[model samples]
Target: MCRNWGGGPLLVVECESDVSFSGEENIGLYQSSQWAERGFCKQCGSHLFYKLKQNNQYFIPVGLFDNCEGLVFDHQVFIDEKPKYYCFANQTKNLTGAEVFAQFAPPE
Candidate 1:
């Protein structure tokens, strides 16, 4: 989806399931997995969101937001999966793929 995002880090926000927008019919829904769906704008094909149906969690692209003043750069997941060509200077908590999966897993 970086093609639509101009090839850089993508900031995002996690939102609840009930989030909605006006003219939602113009958005396209893509099935990314058994439990996840990716939404994009139909006209421009901009990557909009990645939604997990099991928990009704919507991971939204932060570029769409108007004000992000209160947000903080927290954890970076799948750090090991990132390409070696680029890196971030921020000293933050980083998680590997397995750790991210475990973090998102439901507690017993």
Candidate 2:
């Protein structure tokens, strides 16, 4: 996340289904990891979403939405990798990178 998202905490909305884009020509995809890819806007270089290679799951940055009325900051991932300079006051579920992989990684 840090390597792709300009080295900061990125708030993303995880979607279980495929996210449709109106301007497909402006979207650029980079294979960020073995299991996923990151999408960006080619015209403005704005980071779009991180998508799983194995599924339709997409982690779209919350900032892209026009209205954030119902969104909740209930959980966080890669807690161990978060920079020590910033902190959150919310009493939410947090998971380390290893814990995330353990819970979501497919059985081999």
Candidate 3:
């Protein structure tokens, strides 16, 4: 379970494979218009959460939270870009690239 500094929603993700990373390298994807902030476990280097900069919302990969209980997903973004190797069996709303950009685009 992952929580922000304010102790609000607990972000959860299940890990499909082990992820190892050095502390010095950046763990997230960011650009001029979009950002996908990521958090990792310091001890085991596990990917924790992916946060959106536009709405201050977050999404957990669900793979890292295998044992996590009672968590809900509001939606899923980048469904089209999702890797073909894996599939999420849940029935949450999946957002396309254009839909996500329109909704989360930076204000003019």
TM-score of each: 0.82, 0.90, 0.46
Error of 2 at 98 (Å): 0.8
Please give the distance, in angstroms, between residue 1's alpha carbon in candidate 2 and its true position after superposition.
3.5
The residue-by-residue lDDT of candidate 2 on 10-39, one tens digit each, is: 888988665689999999999887778889
Look at candidate 3 and give me any clashing residue pairs: 13-62, 13-64, 13-65, 14-62, 14-63, 14-64, 14-65, 15-63, 15-64
TM-score for predicted model 1 compared with the true structure: 0.82
lDDT agreement of model 2 with the native: 0.84
Per-residue CA lDDT of model 3 for 1-108, tens digit only, reads 122321333334433234454554555443323454666665566555556665556555556555656666656666776656766667888888789778866755
Best by lDDT: 2
List the pairs of residues colliding in candidate 2: none
Candidate 1 residue spans exceeding 4 A from truth? 1-6, 105-108
lDDT of 1 by residue, 4-78 (tens): 344866667878887887889889998866667788999888888888867878888888999988987787777
TM-score, cand. 2 = 0.90
lDDT of candidate 2 at residue 103, scale 0 to 100:
72
Q: 1 or 2: which has the higher TM-score?
A: 2
